[model samples]
Target: MTVTAADTVPAATLEPPTGRLSPLQQWWVLTTRGLLKVFRNGEFIFAFVSPALLAICFYLPLREAVAQVATIDYAQYLMPVIMLQSAAFVASSASMRAAVDGQEGVHTRFRVMPMPTAVPFLARAATNFVLLLVALACGLITCLIMGWRPVPEEYGGGVTGAAIAVLLVAMIGMALTLCADGIGLVAKSPEATSQLVAFPTLILGMLSTGFIPLNQFPEWIQGFVEYQPISQVTKAMRDAIGGILDWQRFEPTLWWTLGLFAVAAVLLVLGTRKAAR
Candidate 1:
């Protein structure tokens, strides 16, 4: 039988799950479903291949030329941003997944089910986090293949050094995912959400210090390049690995990241209300 929205239970019944699984368990069930969809759609392979491809595409043509400009091996200079490219990919994937759910009225159905209010958000976040981690691993392996290492003076001081850099990058990746997921909910279609995010990702990724250094940019725009979020993250990760990360350089980016998280939270609240209606 075809059931209309009027036939569905009210949001009151969606109160936190009671008997079967705890709220946490209910959330995990949805999370597992999201993860399975990702795997079945072959996003897993793309998640791995996209980062490696970014590393290769940038490293091949510009290595020698950029080496002279940055005064470091181009591979080392390009390393952080390469991982960032992967992070962006993961963020995009988050949007696609959320948009799919929204379009299919999955959020609407969940709202009427007997689960906690936060379950949908948590389930989406859990799936995105796992995929982001996988993307990070793929990016690391790709960088290593192209000559990035934890050399004390160069790449990283070893595990400790790499950890610091990775932590910062992970935080940024999570923040981006939050915003993208919100966008997906609002857009309510996979294609729409993906299209909406592409411009910002392309502009920020290219116009920042990801591929080219600050000095390489025009004098007038150099400040913008230095201050942008992507450049800040790339600089933070690079400095951490090199054992030079400090409050001064990282502080602004931290603030920007926090602001982004706040924006995402507000958007999510609004989106949930929209889905409920």
Candidate 2:
């Protein structure tokens, strides 16, 4: 029991447990990790490629045909829908990411961690926001290359209008991403998530006025086509870019986006609770 100097352990002073990360810091770390995952999985590449493909597919074959019927510039007319399509792509990716996280128990792990309950969801939202921006940028570039211009003659929105158009896209895109992410959290698998996301996106995008003028649609379903969320949001962005955005033009889109935000919030809460279980 003779304690030698060598055996004398200094009173093992414990460094205070490292301070917990602030919510912002926690969100940033999670967001960075999510972005890295997105890049490695090649979603980043698709963010660029998908829009380009969409532009070519729609603008090349249909441009001439569209011109024969409507006196509008196909590229200009098609830009808003294309932008919305890019948002849909982002939403699909968000859905898959959330599904994968849930399937792999990432959310469950977060539930046990010493962070706010909302951090993980917020981080996912931040990651989706970045991807949405990338998708939007690619969509814009593709449209520009295909002859869509931000000229006053085309949209008449000028700089102010262009800014509004961007804001509208961001708003609608985030709402879509959040909603898709919520669905994804409860999805059984990424495959299922993709199917869930694709069906509505296809139905909405194809039926909307993005590819053609509303007047061109058959008289039967034009009312549904006009009032649907996709068409309304697309019209808002188009008019904003054209510098003609007004309460009358934007009211429906605003309502739709708000409704989507509320739905997404509820779904996310349920999803988080499900993950905790």
Candidate 3:
């Protein structure tokens, strides 16, 4: 019997080159794919829209209303919360991406492929990080147009201090993206992940100093409003931007960032294990 060319072939040769790509290459490929999806799906269009909405909807109406009592620059005050909100945006999108991948069999395909375990998750995170930056940049521009300036008059850290503050916000955002990935992996459905994420983000954003100054809150819940993780982050970011970061205000925020790292790590393990099973 003639085996022909088909029988002579080692079948493995036709398989995808998962093994051929180095870890960095794999990460890059996955990152690019994620970014492409973000661009093509038009997810980022809303990133721009949100900042505009926040700028006009909340900023315009609330500016003078808050000033009558507080004497604070509302745009500057709202900027940190706006930036932090972008972090949550990235996380929600990350979870959605994870759910879509699982729903579409991309996760299953990754399991069968011979790639590092971290590649898939990290790639998604990296993509989210990029989007986070873009979203925040858009938010920053909107805030600036609304008269939010990063002048270091209070903290006296000046331009350098302002840069550090931005860096800190960016770092916090990266950490949040990781946390989102963990949640995404565990929930395994975009809808569940978004619902899971929305509660804390909303509660914290509303209650935190980023939205309303701590002193402005009612006496009863002021303690929680002051020390909650989002509040701490917002306060620290505000001080950092103002060039007024002293060790006292900086320490707790650092610890909170570390805590988020731990949460992300644990979730990643649990979600990956479930996927493997």
Candidate 4:
């Protein structure tokens, strides 16, 4: 006997099963999704272009002067520093984007999702770190094209040193981003936020070894400059990727970076909690 149409319920009309991902899985998915967004955004190219171009232009005339005092190529010496500068910019931009997202209610949506609390910020940090690495690789290639050839032993040591320095910088970036995200929440407008972030960026970039060597400054000013986190990181980066490996110089900077990261961790926790409320 044929069943009446009203008596037979279709399986498709039933509610679909809602599957939730584990915390770790959710974090991974969020991170991967963030990375994909970065790739699709054409942001990688835009991020690297200005810095790379400026580095090339700035190094051209200095090549001869650099060759006179050192056996090593000056472009190679400067490449790491340029990478640091570019990475800092990329990190700041990432933070700014996060702030924008928060302002636009995107972060709020993520908060309601099944994702972990840490995923959004961590995903931003991961994406920024990857972009920074890409910028570094490109900077290195640019150096090579400019006739900078690194010695094998020196290269290995430099790589190790650069890695350490970058790790610290990434921590600093994440911390700053968290702080910025908090600031963005309260700011009445994006323009206000931009104005707030600009000076610190300029001051930190200039005061550090990013633009010029620390020794170029007067002796009395050197003490304060050396103590600043930017200075320490830049010094560590420069020592790692530029000249001879010196643990004496490297150790202190490394410690300072770690200390800054610890402080940043505290700030981030407080900031995120505040933002949540």
Candidate 5:
């Protein structure tokens, strides 16, 4: 062949077109991809169904039992835990999705792409966030159907109490899904991720003060029940819903949230480094 510049240069050395997407645009594209995957997988439907199921399964059976034991309305008392469970559902789903991606070499492909490392991570987070909102909405509807109402008077009116309650629920969701996503990256497979995510959620949720009152638990275990992260978060949510937000009531939850965020950051660093390799 005759020697020429084009002939001498390899295709790999060609520069990208000027029309290439910016980081933000790339993020949006990836986010759309993730969201589509979630939709095709029926995660949105699960997000709605999970909270409704949790509310119905727990409320119908235990309403009478709870009423007999305490003066509180069962629906109102159960609302916080229902919200928390919705958050857990988001986390579990995120974990499985991330694991599936890892197993299918999606992560490896992404690593070789021109996008930043954080793009895929953030896109996955955004997808999980949308699912979390749906889960929370379903939980809210279920609670309303079950007679759970927020008292505006508790937080000086203007929806402040309801806003705080929603904020707390969102915080819980973000912390959990981030941590679970990172765990999924590290897990061997979707099956392993499922077990890992479910175990803590089940244990902490069942053993917490969410379903039962503190006094109902045995004295020996009461201390743990009172101070556990789930219980603390539930209590804070309850207080916010009840229009009783205060430093004393919210301190434990705040501290626990910060701690969970720290853990999530560490796990994300590890997960990204592992993927990079």
Candidate 6:
């Protein structure tokens, strides 16, 4: 069959659809498609393994050392922080992937499609959240193996409190991912993006309550550290898991996390819009 290019063209290509997807439909479709892609890429497995390995190889030893000095079980105190660290690292990398797509012209293609421009970012955020949850599960399993158990009877600490803490940490991850998206737009080049965003995030992850207790630091440093988003988020997660369950005391940290997220959202919206243009 020797058909001309014009003859072979589809009727839809000859006359493209006129209507756009509804905002809700667009978001749903994009998020689902993005998640499917992530699953196909084995991101779920990678997320689990990376954190589980770190928890075993790094945190276990640190747990042993901290156990000697700390009144509470070190693994119990450290698990929540590990979850946060895993979330933070994964979220940042996810944002970098979004930026890479932007640079590769994939984002431009999506912008021109009948979908909302925010879909890619939203999907990335959702994927990061899912991956973080998996990481949290892996961490909990590791803690259990290391002889750290949740005292459900004491302070009503059970799955409910742990789940709430996970959600909060995931929200913090979302905020950080947005911030990374903004940074990715600024860097444009992958190499530059890796150096600029990755290093600072790693440093912040270490300095923030991820590795050591904030009280161990100097008073002056503690004041500044307490104000950081990571610190507040970590504190909230710890309080939740430690069975303190004091929402009133943790509310301030939650508010701070929300404020930081709001800022990051604004930055992401502005940067993505600018990049699209």
Query: Which candidate number maximizes lDDT?
Result: 2
Ranking by lDDT: 2, 5, 1, 3, 6, 4
On residues 131-186, what C-alpha lDDT tens digit does candidate 3 reach at each position?
Answer: 99888888777778888877756556676766777777788888887888888778
Return the TM-score for candidate 5, rounded to 2 decimals.
0.92
Off by over 4 Å in 4: 1-16, 22-25, 61-73, 152-189, 192-198, 242-247
Better of 1 and 6 by lDDT: 1
Instruction: Mark the 10 consecutive residues where model 3 has the least summed lDDT.
Output: 152-161
Q: Which stretches of candidate 5 lie over 4 Å from their true place?
A: 1-16, 152-158
lDDT of 4 by residue, 62-133 (tens): 667656655645665565556556655664566566667667877668778767788776776666667766
Can you list the residue pairs that collide in candidate 6?
Answer: none
Evaluate model 2: give its TM-score. Answer: 0.94
Q: Candidate 2, residue 150: CA error in Å?
A: 1.1
Pairs that clash in candidate 3 = 155-243, 155-244
- Candidate 3, residue 124: how far the Cα is off, in Å: 1.4
TM-score of each: 0.90, 0.94, 0.90, 0.74, 0.92, 0.79
Once superposed on the true structure, which residue ranges of model 6 sit more than 4 Å away at CA? 1-29, 218-220
Which of 4 and 6 is ahead in TM-score?
6
- Candidate 5 lDDT, 1-277, residue by residue in tens: 5798987888867867567788899899989999899899998888878878887789999999999998888888898899889899999999998999999889888999988888999899889898888888988888888898877583432267877988898997899899999999988889999999999989999999999899999999999999998999888887776777799998888888888788888988887877888
Residue 238's lDDT in candidate 5: 79
Please list the Cα RMSD from the true structure of every candidate, rounded to 1 decimal place: 7.1, 2.2, 3.2, 4.4, 3.1, 4.7
Q: Write the per-residue lDDT of candidate 2 for residues 1-277, one digit (tens) a residue.
A: 8888656655544345667889899999999999999999998789889889988888899999998988988887888888888899999999998998898899999999999998998899889999999999988888888888785745398767867887888898999899999999888889999999999989988888878888889999899999998899888887887878899999999999999999898888889889888
Clashing pairs in 5: none
Distance from true position, residue 157, model 1, in Å?
3.9
lDDT of each: 0.86, 0.88, 0.82, 0.63, 0.87, 0.70
For candidate 1, the lDDT comes to 0.86
